[model samples]
Target: MILLCPPGVYKAQSDTHLLAGRVAQLAHGRHVLDLGTGTGALALTGARAGAQSVTAVDLSRRCVATTRLNFLLHRRPVRVHRGDLYEPVRGRRFGLIVANPPYVPSETSVLPRHTRGRSWDAGPTGRAILDRICDGAPEHLEDDGTLLLVHSAVCGPERTLERLAAAGLSAEVVDRARIPFGPVMRSRAQLLERSGLIEPGEHLEELVVVEARRG
Candidate 1:
């Protein structure tokens, strides 16, 4: 319904909606956890799909507020928490977990702390947040639960599958979308090419949704 994204808050984009679609499909009867719930799109989708409960976590206060505001606007309920990934929901397991974290490959490996870059400036390999999510997801997912992660292919979706598999989860790419580079990707195109993450003159990136299941 109404999605108000202030200056610093992330606007719900294609990736967010893509994951939300899957959230709507799998969230029924589940306790859902949405990591990086920027605008609460996915969390709200989970609730709309009849989730038992929905909890959204974000490190940015602005994102947390925006997510809550969106929930209020739509009359949906959610537990919005302001904390880094998995920190606020420590030891709490969810029947379904969804994430659309930053997966843009940046110049350095260091993640942003307070700046707007924290929204999309993922580390050089773009696994800064992705890896952490993979490593921590197992403990936070109930048996038979599923984790849905959407990220750019340039950051290596296969690596995500590998990491999750190493963690004893059955993982696979469930969906993919190829779109022309957005502003951020256009700006970092040259760097990505130089770093061998993409081909020279490549103006498109494939966004993939990887689903990992705990059994």
Candidate 2:
């Protein structure tokens, strides 16, 4: 199987861990979109999994260029575009849209540093990005298409499901795993107080995969 390690020149965290293979499992002969496609890991993985077409979007020009390089290096046919969220592909629908958006509560928090405003920060409660994604995802997804997202389980999967429900979508936790806490863990802990993120004395968590679909 072809693999993409990581890209150089961006301290931006990956959209998803083990993203390359993770996406391949869900993508098959479908048009796929990888939001915040750093290093094109997920996008390339989807392509190798036989996606009909794969498009990667990032706000960073460097990420866009890096994704193109990685795509060419892997001989994967993926279109890399520099844009925020769904701007580049506005009005276009996909069978699958995958994102590992910045779920950390604060952009200024010490974790992995990338160019400013890269969509990694999730605001004070870390739900900022999640909110937008939940609200806007339905518009971009086909009736039966799926939106796959990775975030901290600490972000309250129940809250996320509620937000999606409010947006006229149905969401469920498809996969979840634990990883080490980076510097941002501190702030998330504090914000949890306000958002009821998780409970105290609960084990700290790293990532969660939420797969939702529009009705």
Off by over 4 Å in 1: none
lDDT by residue (61-146, candidate 2, tens digit) is: 77788788888888778888887779999999888888877776663444343654444566666776677778878888877888
lDDT of 1: 0.91
How does each model score on TM-score? 0.98, 0.82
Please name the candidate that would achieve the greatest lDDT relative to the true structure: 1
C-alpha lDDT score of every prediction, in listed order: 0.91, 0.73
Candidate closest to the true structure, highest TM-score: 1
Q: Kindly give the stretch of ten consecutive residues in candidate 1 with the minimal lDDT sum.
A: 1-10
- Candidate 2 similarity to native, TM-score: 0.82
Model 2, C-alpha of 158: deviation from truth (Å): 1.2
